[model samples]
Target: MDSYICQFPGCFKQYKNRCNLKRHEEAFHTENKKFQCVHCKKILSSKQNLKEHEFIHTNQTPYVCREPGCGLRFRHGSQHSAHKRIHVAIKNIVNRSSVVSFKLSNIEEDIEEEINPKDMMDFTLPLIKRSQDYILPVI
Candidate 1:
């Protein structure tokens, strides 16, 4: 029934309670950060914020695209969702036969570069055949 408003210039955001207004101010209006990252020493305001920041140091990519040839990795769900739009656009363009081939050629190259050869089940090393005489004994 009551509203607590932020008094900062140019920002008149209103909150339902005093506690929320204070948190909003501390998070945005001030540099009074409480949580410090152990890996990079970066300061954050809350535990959730610190946890999100820690992903950068850990190189964690929990959100993965399940598209057939893509398999791109992302740290956040929003990033994964945004990447899916590119695939959708590609599918829409595929109806146009001429542009489809040219665009897909470039996209396939980019996808190939992003994919790790070791992760592919079919990836293998080339074998060289040698005769018995060519195999010399080690000294």
Candidate 2:
């Protein structure tokens, strides 16, 4: 029985040739893994590796299409088609907002400015937060 080094850190498999590795990947690694190895021409066994492969093949991003009235942002035509169905043509009218009285006994009445919704979007997109932000910088 020969042992082959798994490019994935924690997988256990033994193979001596290309066909054996391919069989191992298909049988035990495909759907369970996050990414396929590019060198093996196999789908990754780790999500990390899949994402890394994407970066290497970034120029091959062929999936794209614009959704009507959606302002055009999606990775694939199917995604854009899905968006088009959801962002329907509906006329939205912003009627002057009427203030309702809610009595709060302990709060002061010093709040005078209205919160603009558009301003929120300006500040919000930057603060959407990403998983990468918390990753400690690799020195």
Candidate 3:
């Protein structure tokens, strides 16, 4: 099989197909951003990127978690997936038998900030709290 390597300096990306190589160059190397956001007028490289960017102005969060009592919505699938892990960790903690193990040394810093529930009345986003901060039932 023939490989198409990108000629861009410092970019050693290789593709099996010729069209894929061209797409990579157009998307990353070239400044030919033809697609523009209708609301913000921000130029994007591709149609998909432009559509995703437009969601910010439209306030359309297509990715929603169906977890009971938590209907949090996100603009991206990655954000929604990360949010779902919180629910999984909470459930594991409650059950006690199925705790997910991880190295504490690997953690760099806390990604969440302490927030009062009363202050979050206007927002749909959940109040992220540390595991130790929660008052779990005595098991």
Per-residue lDDT of model 2, residues 1-139, tens digit only: 5566556558866566766576457546567654556555667664534554565556344344344444655544445666665545221111111111222212325543455667767774455565631222222
Instruction: Give me the overall lDDT of model 2.
Output: 0.49
Compose the digit string of candidate 3's lDDT tens values, residues 61-128: 99899998899999866589889999999887766532322322224235235555787787776576
Of the two candidates 1 and 3, the one with more favorable TM-score, higher being better, is 3
Give the lDDT of residue 51 in candidate 1. Answer: 76
Q: What is the lDDT of residue 24 in candidate 3?
A: 72
The candidate, 2 or 3, that scores higher on TM-score is 3
* Model 2 regions more than 4 Å off: 1-62, 65-71, 76-78, 89-139
The lDDT for every candidate, in the order shown, is: 0.78, 0.49, 0.75
Question: For each candidate, how many residue pairs have backbone atoms clashing (under 3 Å)?
Answer: 0, 5, 0
TM agreement with the true structure for every prediction: 0.41, 0.22, 0.46
The TM-score, computed over Cα atoms with residue i paired to residue i, of candidate 3 is 0.46
Evaluated against the true structure, the overall lDDT of model 3 is 0.75
Give lDDT tens digits, candidate 1, residues 25-105: 887899889999999898888675677678899999878999998899988665887899999976665545445556667
